[model samples]
Target: MDTTKIEKNFKKLTSSNKIFESVLMIGNASGDFNFTREYKRDIDTPMLMASTTKLLTTTCIYALVQEGKLNLKDELSNYLSKEEISGLHVFKGKEYTFELTIEHLLSQTSGLPDFYLTGTKPVFSKVKDRDFSYSFEEELEWIKHMKARFIPGTKRKAYYSDVNFDLLGKIIEAANASTLQEAYEKYIFSPLNLKHTYLANTESDFIPHTYYKDQRLYRPLFIRSCYASGGGVTTARELMIFIKAFWKGELFDKTFFSKQAQSNPLQMSFYPIHYMGGYMKITASYPFGKKYTLVGHSGSTGAFAFYCLEKDLFIVGDVSQIASPSTGVRLAMRTVLAAE
Candidate 1:
């Protein structure tokens, strides 16, 4: 890779002609090789992370496990299923189907319907009682109303649903006697000193109206993200600090870290990144052995941030210049992997 041209393009990408606002930060964990091109502002600004909150959900569950508050194998009903579920299967209308387990839920194998669509059922439903407002608890209730689409733990199809993390979030709170926000603050964000990163309960403080234009990536103007899971907000520097510490086995146990690596396999991969519980792992294939696991997740809703450990690097910013998840990584992968 031509670092010089990439650098030049980095500057061009931040230019107003190609973008309205931009921030790109790339650097190693050990205070090495820090570079940034940002016409928008500094690296400390906050951007919504979209689905990256899944990683936080995983860490929160891990904390519960550490505290002996949860066992992953326990059934969903054993812990947090508030609605009356006699078996794994609940009778909806007239159909009595199979059960949904907590393991299935965590592994994305529950066969539950996507909460984004079903949870937003009012948009598709005419029934009034079925109507539900957007909130953390309501999101969980939405999952309670769903039946497995297939036999739980059997189907492998990818269903990127916020309900997955929402369930995990519920697990954290139910086990800890607190909300997901509090649990996250206590177990993960606070202990690690991630003062800037937050699993937001509201967007009142941030996500203001702004104007930006970048052709390569899509980003929305100031708006609010519905309550579910994912869509967190944070800065690149804070994300990097978290990633570097997590990657080096300093923040978590070594044995668990290795298993965490195993949590992601080739099948779960989505090109530039692979899915592990909720976090996305990206390995650098272009430069041969420049493999890195991007410990954070990317949001389709205009925010992508990562803590890359292979390079001891953490890169957070909008590649599109506006408030959009950077398409740079995918664009790089496509250039190398796609056929002419």
Candidate 2:
């Protein structure tokens, strides 16, 4: 594949706006056909994974399933105490907290409101002004005051909630009898030989500052608090390895993906993006004329890890800009079109 266009677009976009630093790596399923580009940051620079960490959480969950430690059909109450989950999903005056299943959470059909983006007090808006940390229990308390979007397992309806994966992180711990970080090490990072990828757990973990427009915000406490939902750190080079493993069944059985293949359209704010299992799926057809699908996820910090199925291309990168989360997605799409 001629990467002239890819290189040109990368330089053009990185040099233009709020992107403080950026790195990209594009490659085929095979080891050959590799191309990488960087602007103000090297390929090995550690960057926040943001919501793309959901893919890592998803991989670990599947690993537990393979180990017979958990089941998709298991109830949330089976792992979490009733007091902890009760009144968490009361929609239309009916309590649906006990009705939530692992499948529902994994598929983003749990009707849970996002603590980071929803409620009278959303953490997102305050993130730019200041930096602070809250425990998982605090997050649950925040969500309890919020309203659920729909009933659990509502047909064709999906809401993007960070709490879903946050809950999954708890379930993984409950089932495996270990910390989420340990599970990740055993099932993902260690197995993949990834030295730089890690779940940020403490002030010592070295969480990088993300650009929220022109202001650089260093929220180590908040990033560590993200936990399973979006608290991962990795380099562009390592992310490329993990994403390829994720789609190739190296972390878990690829066949399990078929069960979660059916995707549902998310809320309008996430237009042109769909929720499938634990990741985001994008089907590009309009404007470009050719319909092709990209499977994987994008992050609020302008991080992206996706595979263009038709092109057999794995695209991994980070723009490190929180104000324009979709920047990485648009870049990936342009790279896909350029590769052709």
Clashes of each: 4, 0
Error of model 2, residue 118, in angstroms: 2.5
322 Cα displacement, candidate 2 (Å): 0.6
**Model 1 clashing-pair count:** 4
**What is candidate 2's lDDT per residue for 1-340, written digit by digit as tens?**
7788999999899778778799999999988889999888888899999999999999988888898988899999999999888889999899999999999999899989987766777798999889899999988988888989999998999999999999999999998899999989999999999999999997789898889889988999899999999999999999999999999999898888787657999989888898987888998665858888899999999999999999999999998888889998999888888886
- The estimated TM-scores of all candidates read 0.72, 0.98
Model 1 scores a C-alpha lDDT of: 0.54
Deviating ranges (above 4 Å) for candidate 2: 286-288
Model 2, position 79, has a per-residue lDDT of: 97
| Candidate 1 per-residue C-alpha lDDT over 7-114 given as tens digits, one digit per residue, 9 for 90 to 100 | 665665554364555566666656757766566556787755556566667666766776788876766666654453333234344332225555555666555666
Candidate models: Cα lDDT each: 0.54, 0.90
Best by lDDT: 2
